[model samples]
Target: MNYRTILITALSCALVACQQTPTKPHAPNNLVTQAPALGAPVAVYTTAKNTEQRLSQGTTLTFAKSVQPSEGEISVFVNPHKSFQTFIGVGGAFTDASAEVFAKLPQDKQQELLTAYYDKEQGIGYSLARTTIHSSDFGSHSFTYIEEGDKELKTFSIDHDREFRLPLIKQAIDAAGGELLVYASPWSPPAFMKSNNNMLKGGKLLPEYFESWAMYYTKFIKAYEAEGIPIWGITIQNEPMAVQRWESNIYTAEEERDFLKNYLGPIMEREGLGDKNIVVWDHNRDLISQRANTIFEDPEAAKYAWGIGFHWYETWAGGTTMHDNLYNVAQSFPDKKLLFTEGTNERFSRDKYQHWPNAERYGHSMINDFNAGTVGWTDWNILLDENGGPNHVQNFCFSPIHADTRTGELIYTPSYYYIGHFSKFIAPGAKRISTTVSRSHLLATSFQNDDGKTATVVMNQSDDDIAYNFIVEDKEVELTIPARAMQTLVY
Candidate 1:
């Protein structure tokens, strides 16, 4: 839970590329440059400053030579970032924005901004997005494909979706430069199956309706396929361990295991829906052991699920666990893919109000996650209202950008710039390379493209300048890093 505090403080950007640097520690004075603000005067380095500080583009970016590659190796492809959990995708309040906000914008302007956001990945990168099947913690209230208790499940339909979600989602997908990774998850079950009789409060699917729920997932896959959106994987539940005050369900490990093995597994297979991937434990990192045990106990459940999903809610870090505890699942369940399903530093809680330095966040997360064998990485709320959203749910965090709900306005958040610092450049097929770090506060990661190009990312969390050396391929470079900054170097 304190992760939000740590993460929020790391990326409280109000801003990518190669923000990489050297790995050794030195002094702070070396990395200092005449930095420029978002819209500030461009600096002109005099010949004297350039001679003394080795400045370029008016910035003092220095390099220090290394004696040897940090210490070990992190090969990008040979030991690729492995994860069985395929992405369910991520987007937010934006689906509703068309009616509430985008409708007010001129058609040309709407098309332009939409293209910029959803299309950037098409040029050389990739984008996999997620959305709720209906209402979610970020939506107005609890809802499903249809009103509840209509037996025989004949009325089960996503017809209402065509008017809202499908259109907006389709628009974004088409805008993406390449094929989009599309998946859907539910925040709650149809109200009928709940004990409280409302999706707003948590409920357990009364065992009798198990088959119906399985069919529900299949129907969604079939429906999306009909609309040209293929459902790649269906996460059994979103945040299984979270019993929130909004649309949610409470499913214990035993319940999920039984449901996946006995109900969902057989039903989907019988329905010839076996090609789709089944994932479990769409919860936080702390619950990895719980998920591991449940999947391990029920051999049948383990057989059906390709992998598991986790969030960054709790800080599972300790000095002795091979790296932090976040790596334990990958360390223990090496064969099962680990997908980080849903995460956001600013979940709109009063606790989210603060400044998290940008360098430590996106850079650090991408480092740890890929290192932990996470193949699919996504954030919550692709877009939100300027004030975070027209969210009745209040706890809605956001993506890199937010389109105003009342007016056609766009506001880019730090998270957007942060994600772009990575996603906009690293394509899906790209591999993370091996790396080693010797300094405590100096964090690092590396990647290798299929064509043999090299990319290394490093972040210096200390408040002072540091000197370091980095060796890529066979060339060694010396670097001097400044305090309060992060860097990425690619060759």
Candidate 2:
């Protein structure tokens, strides 16, 4: 069934008070004489199946004595003390299309959109952001910062960004309470620097221009900083393995490693941009292991790399998402980090704004990725036009939120609430804690924020409403999750 129909059905059930099987109280686990205090009561915020609730605050839950799980009864157990990776943050990209659309919206709508995404209380509280270095397929056209054939590296400027992109980014930083970790990635280097002399198709960077290309990154970083936008990090290339119709560059595993070790790494240091994170293999999960191994195995190359960045498009060929690959990389390189750089539901249709699966796609990935050891997650475009984009090559895709520039209205997709389930409650510097679920239908992940508050996210994708016990340490809270819903229990 279509999403709207499903949502209507779900809402009807909610209004009528859908019945759930009750769980009989079980004997307390006598393993502990006293269970640790679970702090304040947990505030439940949920986005439920077929309901208008989008991150809507629900009933508060107080922890009681722990109960033993009965067979077939679903339960989520969270261990906040046992933590894994530190969470960087969760956010979306500020692509040219997003910026351009923002520029077209009415003044109040612009503020509304910015507030909807960045305000800690009113919005989703995004703490991370990504943007293209110059131009990507999401831009209106391909362009470079410098004039063509200026190999002397004297003509660098970012005047193009001052018009629309920079303003939006600056406002976003302000809306985010004056702090947002922003990063950039290049789809392709300038045409003159590539073998094909065009940035549209996949082409290798000519060996002669390696140093110049390395210098380009430093220039971009400095220019943006001068514009009052601090660049937190940058990926060497976006989707280095793919050959697409839009801007793309090819770099085999070995080639990317060499460029970092011998060129990009040292240049950034010499230019005093060493503090900026250098991420390698901003590609997909399918070959993330190969790319991470090749670059991270080399001490020289690995030294400069802050982490490995990846995308979610590897599943486009109808293959299962290679989530285990992320675990393998994390297990292999405990010192390095993993960041989900970019991902969005592709092939956007205006009618599918309420599409439930798009949101499920996000919940599924975020849970698995965090469980598998990813520090942060980034969605591709924060906002796109009604057409799904003003994309240069018409490579349209779905964003969590889209603006109908023609109508001056904003559309918040289910994906937006799906992402908010995590980003809103889990602050940066939060650490992933251990969470065990008793059923496969219910997926869960938990994080303890720096402020000592723990947020546990549980997603129910099954068709049947499920009653589950939320357990932490020796405390338990009985909860019921509607079919195809997600909840973030925060205390």
Candidate 3:
């Protein structure tokens, strides 16, 4: 079916579901239904078994008196009053590769992409964004803002980004209703500032260049702001513990802590850029807790850190994702925030554009991460070419949306819809409410918006379609989730 037909059918289903009146009880054995004073109608949207059903609106469920769930029956319970972390937002990195690819697309396609990601009415509302400090593996080449030996940074300029990156970022901010919380991260400092004098293959930041390196962040923030792109924060380093063929830098937890407290933090304050958030440990979950302890346990360093940032790459070794570590850090330092800074399905191939597992990966991680007290989440690259790159190090990876640069065609992956299942309904400033599920096959999270609308996202990964009771306080609604599908119920 065409997009218009699908949208209309979905909306029709929602309208019918919302307007239907309840008849006398034909209550099932598991639920003894009684009339409850209903509040707002619950509108359900699903991206389910059918590819056409992406973010499609389904029936609006009616509230009935809460019933005790039977022994084997599945149920999803949401408590709107009991809330946790205030959501910052959800989005992807606007990397050089994304920007360069975006520049190659047709004008109309470019507009379509911008609207698809940033326009709340026409697209998934992405209020948060990330960009690199210099060059990353995702970029075409290694780069720095200043001349190689310019420690004084007087020769610093963002002219390199003027051609593609900066313009795309500015347009994205405008598309996001003139407000987007953007954070910057560096994969490595300039080669001259590193011990190995190379931007690739993990090297340490030379101790002598500590002061100049700190000043680099301030200069980047100012330069971007000068172009009318306000940076919300900066992570000390990206994947600080990893050694890769691409740009990388290593920082022992203590070294990172000392650098922050002694150099970066004080320098920012001295330069009057202290208000910008400073995020540390932009690495994986395996070392997150240790990194948090090393930095947070030190009062001076802790004062500089706005939060801890982590990635999901540690799971690449073929083990369970260490989601528990996030909770451990959150509980250990309640004052410090947690952010899922980067995650994306690697090993890209044109054939896997419609890959469902990729989408499920996002759904699974996002639900658990938010439940673990993460305030925000960011995906890796916002857009990539059909070949999955323009990647300099030949490390091509998947993006939720890929443009076939040759054909000027856009391929929307299931991951895009999966991400939309949360980002679209859960607004910024929303508070995550308490949500729990009775079945192991299902995963869920809920957030209550400032407007009193609650978005409860449910994911069914099991093979069989499951019917469950969606319970909210004293009321409940019967619902069925398709196998390997995700739904967002908004009320």
Candidate 4:
């Protein structure tokens, strides 16, 4: 069900509490506890009103031997034995625009932000990152690697990105301990490759330029590798169905299938880069299944595609719900992978700038998407200015972190904390384990990482507090979650 369909009701604290501080040491009357283990379940919580707690680490919840799982209270049951999709990671795009503004900050501040995003011990380590093939809507201007009409690509250059993005990527790789898996996406083909002969608006890539454009992908991959920043994967095009005023190109499902089967896929194999992922349909959920089916049904095309990617815009736009489309794709292509490629709230509303609801959207979507079978999730822009720009098309959007390039000050929005509740604890290669919530309002997802640790994140979007027992392995840990808050328990 969509977020709007869920009925939100108030949950009373007395239902789950016995007159104790939420975070202080308190043993529920009936449960027996032993001495605390080195790695007991710890909770980190964030409240909506910016009250109570704000992504603060709370007291550890002790494991009990003999308490019957509360039947009347809401329950979150986690089953690591029944694991599912392996998680790739979570992160945001490293646009040239983001790097340009980031470069404006003092060197110390720049490193601070980088370390905050990529250092596992210091911050929420982001393992996956997206970068524009040339210039996306976030760039200062439209650009391409190849010079005008250079189909042979003798004059191709990534110099434009080297000025800002490449260096920042290298720094981020260092901060991440080289764990970053970078993926590249193109917003539009060069002006010469499109029938409209312009990159600023929707156009069609001429069939004649198919091979040239396919070669362009390899050139970009090789060039970035030369810079010490390997391109792990690439989407054929960004928002392939949209006709936007910004850098965009339209590719019908049939067109995309033919291009990949005949040109892109064959070339990658020929160049011995078959291992690099080729993701299809970098669009929204509204038509995701339809687009995916058209291409994936074609054995020629299906053999080359690593997975299907989608954005959350369709759900926010009141179109198809993200989870439904995700489930559809998962059921139909059980052998393939799924990824949440891009999403961000646009046209920042001052009324909701630091609003917890904005952050709630991220948690809500991520939980649902993960449950629906997405391996990785990537947000739109990693960083944006206070004005939400550097965007050439004037399409301003909110980011997890906003900075004052002029003052060198940074503002961490609730989105950052919400994402941290997941990305920080759930490491790459983690498997999404089965989780069931007794109350619909208590939206949650659980995972078991390769390290053998498990994390369960529960979010309460309702107006009341919830008293619930998190049950696993026949042991139970009782916890109370505040209304309009999220809690992550890592054990």
Candidate 5:
């Protein structure tokens, strides 16, 4: 029985591809609380007898529904109903993986993993990625193309980043058949280009460097090209609104418009970097109004722009029903695309490590964005050390895959598997489609591959088992969702 065909309901003439019957009841809500240590109990349900508990989590994780555990086959049909496309990938995490971390892994394991990373045709796929033009909080330290006090015409080069980060990233991209999509952003301009003369202090980009900084970015792009890496997209600044002690700079709406309208856009056109696109407002989602205001207000700045970008840090309810963290900023103007540029699970909470095991959270973030019509999705950092990062400020969070600094032991977190559900099956060209579930706890989105085969991925991140009946083309089937587990039900 194909899981996807039973549940998907095609709007037009369609065929059932999975075993989804409407008669299947929603899974019962189950809770895993006291009586056992935090992670001591492990129970699986699909294989349980009728009198047994069907859904459980504690020790090893199991994904099973109430249905009998036969060797039943499920084939997912790719019916991409939505008409949109963009790149998807993780950012800052692996690009800046320390030499210390790389040296720890065995040469064979390292090569194997790198091959797995780039050989997208093989499965583990990353079509798009975000990188700091220089060092952001996720990097070794803060630096930029031009040094402080070098306000002259003679010295402007990206020699700092040229040393290792660029080369390391290029190696991975080269192995992937060179299909990686790169979007570069600056956490903060070099200290000399900022109001503050120190990289550690919060400062705004000085107006004086606006034009020269655009030139600086061109050089960075040219330097990477020299290394055989083509940058697909770029943002004016990382978080133009946030001014952190780490590598950060603030850009008010006025400044952003002036920079893009008067400086960056014109310079890119002059240098003939027209093929690579530029996106605006690479900041939080809550500022949709500000983004709409900025882009809508300026015809030229908006004209030269490719799309609008947002991060998932701040929650916006207006866009919630549309998609989990989606905002209504782009509703008025639907022509431009909305892409989630950066988000991470590490929020400096007291229980940072506990956050790592909750693959549901990462799953929630991805589905929320995808449901909201985000063209693509990208996470903050792919790989960070045990404490979340090697951040200079010591403010850290966990990564999808963590490498023990001392042992080199790799612990694949929930984020990794959560990403696999979408990335592994939904390649770069796949388009999202409409999907309806029995209840709200089970969030879902359907996609159609290039060959028109439909892939539907659903997540039951709630603590209880929620049975699902996916109807496509008027045919339905039963799918029992295990509690606190995510299932990619495809036909």
Candidate 6:
């Protein structure tokens, strides 16, 4: 598939072809660019410097015969032969609020946004998606598929989703060539099933309603599958430990473990949905290890869980980051997968939408998360209006693409370009390869795609342009990455 290049400056930027390099000869002390070796050992670079170029197709990078002796230079070593985690691909969420805004756009503009996000040749090529099981903070209002106090769930119907959300998802799936892997998550169960008798505040799932709630999942999954959208997995709850004004439910690790071990797990198996992934602890990475331990220590609960889900909010709140906690979880439960289920910039402002730092945050987190053993990454929203959201609870946040609901305009943020630097080139099932860099300013991760191609993404976060040597086996490509820029060297 042909991938479209993106520019950090504006959404209207069009695709540009790769430029051929000038063949000027160089002296021994200067950087020497040798042609790529025959067959397998070769590399080319495409970069987005956040100025004139965004995902600009650049010249092929040939490995030099020897490393040049220079000051303030760094070296990045890549080992495609030594690979780690298999990537599940990156994508965003589909929320009712997003669909509402999307439906307001003109038909042509709606297709443009979809192409910008899911078209493998012309967009970022998102392969996975998350959807709210009922309603989230991003929804226009609180809603549930089942009627109040319907303990038997005879009234359970996904007709609510058919209105806007599912249709938007179907279009995205079509654009992605029917390769979208969708997972469902609930912010809260129906108000009648919770202790507080309401879904807005922190409430506990009533013990009496446990079985019905488990069955509720089965019905919803079956309904969606009938609509041609397979449910890839389901999270126990979204941010189970937090109490928000928006819809939320509190499930201590113990509560979550018990529900899965006794209720959801057995019900799923009995209904022939056991193969569907059941993820635990859909919360922050700060307490991820503790939660994982609590749930996985029980052999019964562990058997029910397919993986662990986490978010990036903890680090943003001045708490600990992924390194310690993520390492702990990976080391403790090496067999289970780790997925970044939800994350996005907060306190939305239109001015910050184009902000490069926000985009850099995504790159920084993604590289570190991959190094820490995350298999997949999912952003929060696929699209929001110019106001950041039509969020019922006023929990506004920025998305990669923001639609001008009044004028039918689509605005692509810097995050879109930054995310494309990885998602556009790296295909699903790619394995994270070993990549070690000598300097602190440069952060990077390498992946060998399923197609037998290698992609190495390096970001220069420092203010000054720094020359670097990218070495893979016997070959070393010498190049200078501009300041505050990122490049993907794919071969």
Candidate maximizing TM-score: 3
TM-scores, one per candidate: 0.76, 0.93, 0.93, 0.90, 0.78, 0.91
* Candidate 4 global lDDT: 0.80
In model 6, how large is the Cα lDDT of residue 456? 84
Per-residue lDDT of 1-491 in model 3, one digit per residue for the tens? 44423433444221000111111111111222222246647889888765578889876678878889996899999876566777888999999999999999999989888978887766777888999998999978889999999999999999999999999999999988888889999999999999889999999999889999999999999999999999999999999889999999999999999999999999999999989999999889999999999999999999999999999888888898899999899878888889999999999998988888999999999999998888889999999998899899899999999999989988888898899887878877767777899988999999766666778899999978999999988888898988899999887
Clash counts per candidate, in order, are 39, 0, 0, 0, 38, 2
lDDT of 1 by residue, 1-491 (tens): 23212222332111112222221111111222122122222121110110222111234333232244434521111112311221222222234533334444567746655654554432212366666666776644455776568645788787767765677677766776435676667777877777666676577777778888888888888888898887777788887777777778888988889899999989989988998888788787776777877785577888888777777766545422222545666556655666667766564532333333422455466667766656667676655555665465676654455565556666544444334444544545444555556676666655544343334555556777666665433334456555534455544
- Cα lDDT tens digits, model 5, 100-149, are 35545666655645543444444245556777777787766666666566
Model 4: per-residue Cα lDDT over 166-251, one tens digit each: 88999999988875889999999999999899997899999889999999999899999988888889999999988899999999
Which tens-of-lDDT digit does each residue in 1-491 have in candidate 2?
Answer: 33322322322111000112111111111222122375548788788768767777777778887878887778998865566777888999998999999999999989988877887776778899999989999979999998999886799999999888999999999988888899999999999999999998999999999999999999999999998899998999999999999999999999999999999999999999989999999989999999988989999999999889998888889998999899888878877888999999989898898999999999999999988888889999998999999899988999988899889988889998899888888888766777889889999998766556778899999988899988898788998988899998876
Between the candidate structures 1 and 6, which one is better when assessed by lDDT?
A: 6
For model 6, which pairs clash? 2-121, 6-54
lDDT of 6: 0.81
Give the residue spans of candidate 5 off by over 4 A. 1-100, 121-123, 315-327, 347-357
> Ten residues in a row with the worst lDDT in model 6?
20-29
As for model 2, its CA RMSD to the true structure in angstroms is 7.5
lDDT comparing candidate 5 with the true structure = 0.58
Candidate 4 TM-score, C-alpha based: 0.90
Give the Å shift of residue 258 in candidate 2: 0.3
Residue 307 C-alpha lDDT in model 4: 89
lDDT of 3 at 282: 88
Task: Mark the 10 consecutive residues where model 2 has the least summed lDDT.
Answer: 12-21
Global lDDT of each candidate: 0.56, 0.85, 0.86, 0.80, 0.58, 0.81
Candidate 1 residues lying further than 4 Å off, grouped into runs, are 1-109, 120-126, 315-323, 347-354, 480-482
